[model samples]
Target: MKKRRIDIVPLTDQALALLEAIKPYSGHREYVFPADRNPRTHCNSLTTNMALTRMGLEGRLVSHGMRSMASTTLNEHG
Candidate 1:
């Protein structure tokens, strides 16, 4: 495996905070999500999504989804 370059530096403190919250384990080389606690089964952010869905906000869009939703709006209005 080879190290890959990240194109842009984290622009905001919030962005850095999120990255720090999901620290990667050197062994796995991936972000540590809640579902990854049990290595026997592989799970991603779906666990988080399922939790949110239970709150009646399922499919209401998330942080990443919001970014996608807002980028175009911001670009258009800015």
Candidate 2:
């Protein structure tokens, strides 16, 4: 195996706390967003929907829109 450098993205305190709280509920997985009523797999659609709903942008923005915004913001900062 070849050694390679990996860049680390820093998480905020709140993010860390949320992950810590979800740790026990995850059983033995590293995913923070597991499928509802089942911890075996991730539910991408459900996660996106719930997130947009909570942000009050359910009808206004989709997951792709959020990704575009994030990319634009990072590019602007960089």
Candidate 3:
């Protein structure tokens, strides 16, 4: 699974630039992948939650920590 996939409809130059920046593919898919395969293959809710608990024990981040960071960052330029 991939966290992100290419969308060709909104064919802006910026989107094309981002794809080139991350990765390049040599071929095309005959069938579109289902939505469930979006995230990294090995990352699931249980694994992420366990890691978050450990992070919290180490006085690091809690489950909702990233939400605020993303909201703040988006609000700045949103």
1-78 in candidate 2: lDDT tens per residue?
Answer: 235767677998998898888898777575676777676877676689687889899789888888899999989999
- Best model per lDDT: 2
Put down candidate 1 lDDT per residue, 1-78, tens digits, no spaces.
Answer: 236855665468887776676665423444344345665454665665666778788667565676677898889998
Q: In angstroms, how far off is 14's CA in candidate 2?
A: 13
TM-score per prediction, in order, is 0.36, 0.52, 0.32
Error of 2 at 17 (Å): 10
Off by over 4 Å in 2: 1-28, 50-56
Give me the runs in candidate 1 sitting further than 4 Å from their true place.
1-14, 21-36, 39-45, 59-67, 73-78
CA deviation > 4 Å runs, candidate 3? 1-20, 23-42, 49-59
lDDT of 3 by residue, 5-29 (tens): 7654665798678665554231233
Winner on TM-score (1 vs 3): 1
Lowest lDDT 10-residue stretch of candidate 1: 26-35
Q: What clash count does candidate 1 reach?
A: 0
Clashing pairs in 2: none
Task: State which candidate, 1 or 2, has the greater TM-score.
Answer: 2
